[model samples]
Target: MADSLGIRVFFIKGPASVLQGLRQAKLSADVDVFVDPARLDELLQALRERGWHDRPVDPDSRTFPKHSVTVHHSEWPCCIDVHFRFPGMEKPPRVCFESLWVNTETIALAGQQMRIPARELGVLFLALHALREPLLPACRQELDYLGELARREGLSEGLLGLAGTTDALAAVRPFLEDLLPKTTSFVWPEASVEWRNRVASHEPGSARVLAILHATWRVKPRMLWGALFPPPEVFLGTNIYADMSMAGRLRQHRARWARFLRAMPRLVRDLRGLKSSGD
Candidate 1:
C-alpha cells in the first residue's frame, strides 16, 4: 500500500508487536514496506483492509507508540515502526541505504539491537539531536540504551577510552551513573582486575586519573539532568523520563563521559609516543 502510493521508505522498530501487525494485516511480501507521502490516509485504508480499524492503539496502554494511532492490536512485543526517515534522528540521516545498520558493543534481547558503548558512536552522535530537541522518542531511547551499557559495563577503562572526550562524558553522565555500583565490588569483574582495583583505591580527588573515578563516584542525579535535559522545549514524556524508582541513575554518566574525553587526548599522545619510539 505504501509503495504503491509513492511514499518514502523508512525502517520500523522490528518489535514483535510490529511483526503481528504485518501478519494479521496481511501487509505484503516485503517485510519492510514503503508508505506513501499520503501516509495518514494509506494507514487508515490499510487498517480497514485488515478489518482491524477498530482495534485500540495498543491493547495494553503501556505499549502505546508514544503517540496514538487508530489501529491497535494486542501488545505486539516486536512491532514494525515505519517512518519517513530515521524520524527525528539526525546522524544516520542519509536516505540511501535504509536497511544497513551498524551494531555497537552492548547486549541485545530478542531481535532488538543493543547499542554498545564505544563500538557504535553513531548512536551517541544521534544523541546530539535529542540534546538539541529534548522530547524526541529516538533521542530518549538512545540515552536509555547508553545508560544501560554504562551500567552493565561498569565505566570500564576500555569503555572510557572509547568515549574519547571529557566533554562528551560530562554531557552523557546522567545516563551512565544510573547503573553505577554503590560499592566497588559491583564493578565488572571481567575486564582488567588491576584497573578496577586502582579505581577502588582512588579517593575522589584531582591530578591523578583517580580524580576522574572520584568525580564519577560523587555524581548526583540533579547534576546529570541539568546537563542532558537542557531547556528550550521543556521536553517531557512517559518513556524518556526515567521511571521514578530508577531516577537516580544518571549521576555517574557525567564522569564516564568526562573520563572518556580526558582519556582521548592522552590516548592520542600515547599513540604518537608509541609511533615515535617505534620509529
Candidate 2:
C-alpha cells in the first residue's frame, strides 16, 4: 500500500512510536502517517475522542511514534517502524536531520530517499544496537550483516575526514582502539601510521567511528551474545588477536576452523546450557 500510495516509509520495531509525520513535505500528495505512539490509549480513547501528540523521539527506542501499530499496513499481519530520524543511542538534533534533506548524498531503497555515507548509516545501526543492554538477537544479526557487507565493501572515511575537526579523533579513541583489534582484516589491511593515527584521534562516542568498527568485525553468534550481555572480564581491552593466531592468520579462515569443528558439539551444548540458565 505504501508503494502504491508512493508513501515514503521506514520501519522501526520496539515498544513505542516516534513520529506522526514530517512537518515539511516536499509533495502535497504525500501523507506521512505516524504510528500512534500511545496505540493502546488511542484505541481505548477512539470511542472517546482525544488528541495524540506526534513528536520525534530517540530513534533507537520503541518509545517513539512509529511503533504503536501491531498490524501490517501493506502486507500480511506484521509490524513496521516508520522513521525520519537516524536511529541512535540519543536523539539526533534537528540540524543533523537536515543531512537527510538538501546538500546530502542520496540512495534509493524500496524507492525512498536514504541518507548517504551509507556505511555510516549501517554503522549507526550496529553501534546503537550494541549499546543496548540485555541485547536483542535481532540487533546482533543486523550487526553481523553490516559486518559482512563492510568486509565486501569498504566503509566511508567519515572518521578520517573528521581528523582535525572538533577534537574529533580524540573523542572516539577508545571505540577505535576497541574496533582496531577485531576489524584489522576489514579495516586495517593497508593501515599505515597516519591511518591509525586518524582513527585513534576519534572520540569514543563518535557514531561514525563506531560504524567503522562494526563494519570491520566478524562477530560470531556467541560473540554477539557476549557483546549483548557480556560476562565480567571477558575479552576486555579489545582482544583483536583472539581472532588471530600465533602465525597471524584468521583462526576461522585457517586450520583452526577444523579445531573449532571438533569443539562445535561442546560449544553447542554450552550454548544450550547458557540459554537454559537464561544467560
Residues 85-190, candidate 2, lDDT per residue (tens digit)? Answer: 3222222324333332222234454466543333343343334334332134654554455444444444434432332121223333323334333545432223
Residue 205 displacement in candidate 1 (angstroms): 43
Query: Each model's TM-score?
Result: 0.24, 0.30
State the displacement of the C-alpha of residue 105, model 2, in Å, after optimal TM-score superposition: 6.0
Error of 1 at 104 (Å): 17
Candidate 1 local Cα displacement, residue 35, angstroms: 6.1
Q: Pick the candidate with the highest TM-score.
A: 2
Segments in model 1 whose C-alpha atoms lie over 4 Å from true places: 15-38, 57-279
Which residue ranges in model 2 land beyond 4 Å of their true spot? 1-76, 84-92, 101-117, 133-138, 159-177, 180-279
lDDT of each: 0.35, 0.33
Listed per candidate, the RMSD to the true structure in angstroms reads 18.5, 18.3
